[model samples]
Target: MVQQRLFGLIFALVCGLLAFGSVNAGTDGVTAKQAQEAEFELGKRLFTKTAVPACALCHTLRDAGSEGAVGPVLDEIKPDADRVSKALRNGLGNMPAFKTLGEAEIKALARYVSQASGGAGPSGN
Candidate 1:
Protein backbone atom coordinates (compact mmCIF):
# COMPACT_ATOMS: atom_id res chain seq x y z
CA MET A 1 0.00 0.00 0.00
CA VAL A 2 2.80 2.41 0.90
CA GLN A 3 4.63 1.66 -2.37
CA GLN A 4 1.44 2.24 -4.33
CA ARG A 5 0.91 5.56 -2.63
CA LEU A 6 4.52 6.60 -3.36
CA PHE A 7 4.10 5.69 -7.01
CA GLY A 8 0.90 7.70 -7.19
CA LEU A 9 2.68 10.70 -5.65
CA ILE A 10 5.48 10.45 -8.16
CA PHE A 11 3.04 10.23 -11.05
CA ALA A 12 1.13 13.22 -9.78
CA LEU A 13 4.33 15.24 -9.49
CA VAL A 14 5.31 14.37 -13.03
CA CYS A 15 1.90 15.30 -14.31
CA GLY A 16 2.02 18.62 -12.55
CA LEU A 17 5.41 19.39 -14.00
CA LEU A 18 4.17 18.51 -17.47
CA ALA A 19 1.14 20.73 -17.10
CA PHE A 20 3.33 23.60 -15.92
CA GLY A 21 5.62 23.13 -18.84
CA SER A 22 2.68 23.11 -21.22
CA VAL A 23 1.42 26.39 -19.83
CA ASN A 24 4.81 27.99 -20.31
CA ALA A 25 5.04 26.62 -23.81
CA GLY A 26 1.62 28.04 -24.62
CA THR A 27 2.63 31.44 -23.29
CA ASP A 28 5.73 31.42 -25.42
CA GLY A 29 3.68 30.57 -28.47
CA VAL A 30 1.36 33.47 -27.80
CA THR A 31 4.28 35.86 -27.43
CA ALA A 32 5.80 34.66 -30.66
CA LYS A 33 2.50 35.10 -32.46
CA GLN A 34 2.09 38.61 -31.15
CA ALA A 35 5.58 39.54 -32.29
CA GLN A 36 4.89 38.12 -35.74
CA GLU A 37 1.69 40.17 -35.99
CA ALA A 38 3.54 43.32 -34.99
CA GLU A 39 6.18 42.69 -37.61
CA PHE A 40 3.53 42.25 -40.27
CA GLU A 41 1.83 45.46 -39.27
CA LEU A 42 5.11 47.34 -39.53
CA GLY A 43 5.68 45.85 -42.95
CA LYS A 44 2.22 46.87 -44.08
CA ARG A 45 2.80 50.39 -42.87
CA LEU A 46 6.12 50.56 -44.71
CA PHE A 47 4.49 49.38 -47.90
CA THR A 48 1.72 51.93 -47.61
CA LYS A 49 3.38 55.09 -46.34
CA THR A 50 6.62 54.69 -44.40
CA ALA A 51 8.95 53.80 -47.20
CA VAL A 52 10.16 56.63 -49.43
CA PRO A 53 8.12 56.53 -52.62
CA ALA A 54 5.92 54.04 -50.80
CA CYS A 55 5.52 50.62 -52.36
CA ALA A 56 1.83 51.39 -52.80
CA LEU A 57 2.79 54.06 -55.28
CA CYS A 58 3.93 51.46 -57.77
CA HIS A 59 2.69 48.08 -56.62
CA THR A 60 -0.90 47.00 -56.44
CA LEU A 61 -1.66 44.99 -53.34
CA ARG A 62 -5.33 44.47 -52.66
CA ASP A 63 -4.64 43.99 -48.97
CA ALA A 64 -3.14 47.49 -48.76
CA GLY A 65 -5.91 48.94 -50.94
CA SER A 66 -3.25 50.10 -53.38
CA GLU A 67 -4.20 50.43 -57.02
CA GLY A 68 -0.79 51.27 -58.43
CA ALA A 69 -0.63 50.60 -62.15
CA VAL A 70 3.10 50.98 -62.70
CA GLY A 71 4.30 47.81 -61.00
CA PRO A 72 3.01 44.33 -61.65
CA VAL A 73 -0.12 43.21 -59.84
CA LEU A 74 1.16 41.50 -56.65
CA ASP A 75 -1.79 39.14 -56.48
CA GLU A 76 -1.03 37.84 -59.96
CA ILE A 77 2.75 37.58 -59.56
CA LYS A 78 2.79 36.24 -56.01
CA PRO A 79 6.50 36.88 -55.85
CA ASP A 80 8.25 34.96 -53.09
CA ALA A 81 9.81 36.62 -50.09
CA ASP A 82 13.31 36.10 -51.49
CA ARG A 83 12.41 37.78 -54.74
CA VAL A 84 10.85 40.70 -52.96
CA SER A 85 13.79 41.07 -50.60
CA LYS A 86 16.24 40.96 -53.44
CA ALA A 87 14.34 43.55 -55.39
CA LEU A 88 14.03 45.81 -52.40
CA ARG A 89 17.72 45.52 -51.66
CA ASN A 90 19.08 45.64 -55.19
CA GLY A 91 16.30 47.08 -57.28
CA LEU A 92 14.74 45.58 -60.40
CA GLY A 93 14.12 47.15 -63.81
CA ASN A 94 12.19 50.30 -63.04
CA MET A 95 12.30 50.02 -59.26
CA PRO A 96 15.13 51.77 -57.42
CA ALA A 97 16.92 50.02 -54.56
CA PHE A 98 15.60 50.89 -51.14
CA LYS A 99 19.08 51.10 -49.68
CA THR A 100 18.07 53.41 -46.87
CA LEU A 101 15.94 50.82 -45.11
CA GLY A 102 17.66 48.52 -42.66
CA GLU A 103 17.83 44.75 -43.14
CA ALA A 104 15.08 44.16 -40.58
CA GLU A 105 12.78 46.62 -42.31
CA ILE A 106 13.51 44.98 -45.64
CA LYS A 107 12.71 41.58 -44.20
CA ALA A 108 9.45 42.86 -42.75
CA LEU A 109 8.47 44.33 -46.10
CA ALA A 110 9.35 41.12 -47.92
CA ARG A 111 7.35 39.01 -45.50
CA TYR A 112 4.36 41.29 -45.84
CA VAL A 113 4.39 41.32 -49.61
CA SER A 114 4.84 37.57 -49.89
CA GLN A 115 2.19 36.75 -47.31
CA ALA A 116 -0.31 39.28 -48.60
CA SER A 117 0.05 38.10 -52.17
CA GLY A 118 -0.37 34.42 -51.24
CA GLY A 119 3.22 33.65 -52.19
CA ALA A 120 3.72 31.06 -49.43
CA GLY A 121 7.42 31.70 -49.86
CA PRO A 122 10.22 31.00 -47.43
CA SER A 123 11.08 33.59 -44.79
CA GLY A 124 13.91 36.03 -45.47
CA ASN A 125 16.59 36.81 -42.92
Candidate 2:
Protein backbone atom coordinates (compact mmCIF):
# COMPACT_ATOMS: atom_id res chain seq x y z
CA MET A 1 0.00 0.00 0.00
CA VAL A 2 2.79 2.44 0.89
CA GLN A 3 4.56 1.76 -2.40
CA GLN A 4 1.38 2.38 -4.41
CA ARG A 5 0.76 5.69 -2.67
CA LEU A 6 4.32 6.82 -3.32
CA PHE A 7 4.03 5.94 -7.01
CA GLY A 8 0.78 7.87 -7.33
CA LEU A 9 2.29 10.87 -5.60
CA ILE A 10 5.24 10.84 -7.98
CA PHE A 11 2.93 10.60 -10.97
CA ALA A 12 0.85 13.50 -9.77
CA LEU A 13 3.94 15.61 -9.25
CA VAL A 14 5.21 14.81 -12.70
CA CYS A 15 1.89 15.69 -14.26
CA GLY A 16 1.78 19.00 -12.44
CA LEU A 17 5.31 19.81 -13.58
CA LEU A 18 4.50 18.95 -17.16
CA ALA A 19 1.33 21.00 -17.11
CA PHE A 20 3.17 24.05 -15.83
CA GLY A 21 6.04 23.66 -18.23
CA SER A 22 3.79 23.22 -21.24
CA VAL A 23 1.94 26.42 -20.61
CA ASN A 24 3.36 29.15 -22.85
CA ALA A 25 2.36 32.78 -22.49
CA GLY A 26 2.64 35.72 -24.81
CA THR A 27 5.40 38.22 -24.05
CA ASP A 28 4.13 41.29 -22.25
CA GLY A 29 7.59 42.69 -23.11
CA VAL A 30 11.21 42.38 -22.02
CA THR A 31 11.32 39.70 -19.31
CA ALA A 32 13.48 41.88 -17.07
CA LYS A 33 12.85 45.50 -16.09
CA GLN A 34 16.54 45.91 -15.38
CA ALA A 35 17.15 45.27 -19.07
CA GLN A 36 15.13 48.32 -20.00
CA GLU A 37 16.83 50.24 -17.22
CA ALA A 38 20.23 49.38 -18.61
CA GLU A 39 19.01 50.16 -22.07
CA PHE A 40 17.80 53.56 -20.87
CA GLU A 41 21.12 54.25 -19.26
CA LEU A 42 22.93 53.36 -22.44
CA GLY A 43 20.45 55.47 -24.34
CA LYS A 44 21.09 58.51 -22.20
CA ARG A 45 24.76 58.03 -22.86
CA LEU A 46 24.16 57.74 -26.58
CA PHE A 47 21.69 60.61 -26.64
CA THR A 48 23.82 63.33 -25.11
CA LYS A 49 27.17 62.50 -26.64
CA THR A 50 27.55 63.14 -30.34
CA ALA A 51 27.50 59.37 -30.81
CA VAL A 52 24.87 59.67 -33.51
CA PRO A 53 24.69 63.32 -34.30
CA ALA A 54 23.05 64.28 -30.98
CA CYS A 55 19.58 63.56 -32.36
CA ALA A 56 19.02 67.13 -31.17
CA LEU A 57 21.09 68.46 -33.99
CA CYS A 58 18.07 68.10 -36.25
CA HIS A 59 15.12 66.91 -34.18
CA THR A 60 13.36 68.58 -31.30
CA LEU A 61 13.12 66.52 -28.11
CA ARG A 62 11.86 69.41 -25.99
CA ASP A 63 12.48 67.36 -22.89
CA ALA A 64 15.94 66.25 -23.91
CA GLY A 65 17.05 69.87 -24.46
CA SER A 66 17.10 69.30 -28.20
CA GLU A 67 15.69 72.07 -30.41
CA GLY A 68 16.69 71.31 -33.99
CA ALA A 69 14.08 72.08 -36.64
CA VAL A 70 15.67 70.08 -39.44
CA GLY A 71 13.88 66.89 -38.38
CA PRO A 72 10.32 66.21 -37.30
CA VAL A 73 9.29 67.25 -33.80
CA LEU A 74 9.63 64.31 -31.40
CA ASP A 75 6.71 65.13 -29.09
CA GLU A 76 4.22 65.38 -31.89
CA ILE A 77 5.30 62.07 -33.37
CA LYS A 78 5.25 60.35 -29.98
CA PRO A 79 7.15 57.51 -31.62
CA ASP A 80 7.14 54.22 -29.74
CA ALA A 81 10.07 51.85 -29.44
CA ASP A 82 9.14 49.88 -32.52
CA ARG A 83 8.81 52.96 -34.68
CA VAL A 84 11.97 54.47 -33.35
CA SER A 85 13.77 51.18 -33.67
CA LYS A 86 12.66 50.88 -37.27
CA ALA A 87 13.64 54.42 -37.99
CA LEU A 88 17.04 53.93 -36.44
CA ARG A 89 17.70 50.66 -38.16
CA ASN A 90 15.97 51.56 -41.38
CA GLY A 91 15.76 55.33 -41.65
CA LEU A 92 12.83 57.12 -43.25
CA GLY A 93 12.29 60.17 -45.39
CA ASN A 94 15.07 62.66 -44.74
CA MET A 95 16.32 60.75 -41.72
CA PRO A 96 19.69 59.09 -42.11
CA ALA A 97 20.03 55.39 -41.36
CA PHE A 98 21.70 54.41 -38.11
CA LYS A 99 22.66 50.94 -39.26
CA THR A 100 25.92 51.07 -37.35
CA LEU A 101 24.31 51.21 -33.88
CA GLY A 102 23.63 47.46 -33.96
CA GLU A 103 20.31 45.85 -33.08
CA ALA A 104 20.62 46.11 -29.28
CA GLU A 105 21.85 49.69 -29.29
CA ILE A 106 19.11 50.76 -31.64
CA LYS A 107 16.51 49.11 -29.45
CA ALA A 108 17.88 50.76 -26.33
CA LEU A 109 17.88 54.11 -28.04
CA ALA A 110 14.26 53.54 -29.02
CA ARG A 111 13.27 52.80 -25.44
CA TYR A 112 15.07 55.93 -24.35
CA VAL A 113 13.13 57.94 -26.88
CA SER A 114 9.87 56.40 -25.76
CA GLN A 115 10.53 57.35 -22.15
CA ALA A 116 12.10 60.70 -22.98
CA SER A 117 9.20 61.43 -25.29
CA GLY A 118 6.73 61.38 -22.36
CA GLY A 119 5.25 58.06 -23.48
CA ALA A 120 4.89 55.08 -21.16
CA GLY A 121 7.99 53.27 -19.97
CA PRO A 122 8.78 49.58 -20.40
CA SER A 123 6.49 48.98 -17.42
CA GLY A 124 3.60 50.42 -19.38
CA ASN A 125 3.38 47.58 -21.88
Say which candidate scores most in lDDT.
Answer: 1
**Candidate achieving the largest TM-score:** 1
Worst 10 residues of 1 by lDDT: 1-10
Task: Please write out the lDDT profile of model 2 over residues 10-123, one tens digit for every residue.
Answer: 434433444465423335332244344655766665666534666778878866787888988888887887788777877889888875565555656777888888764444
Number of clashing pairs per prediction, in order = 0, 0
Tens digits of per-residue lDDT, candidate 1, 9-111, equal 5434443454466424365443445445756776798899888879999999999999999999999999899999999999999999998776667767888
**What lDDT would candidate 2 get against the real structure?**
0.64
lDDT (C-alpha) at residue 78 in model 2: 79
Model 1 residue 115 CA deviation in Å: 0.3
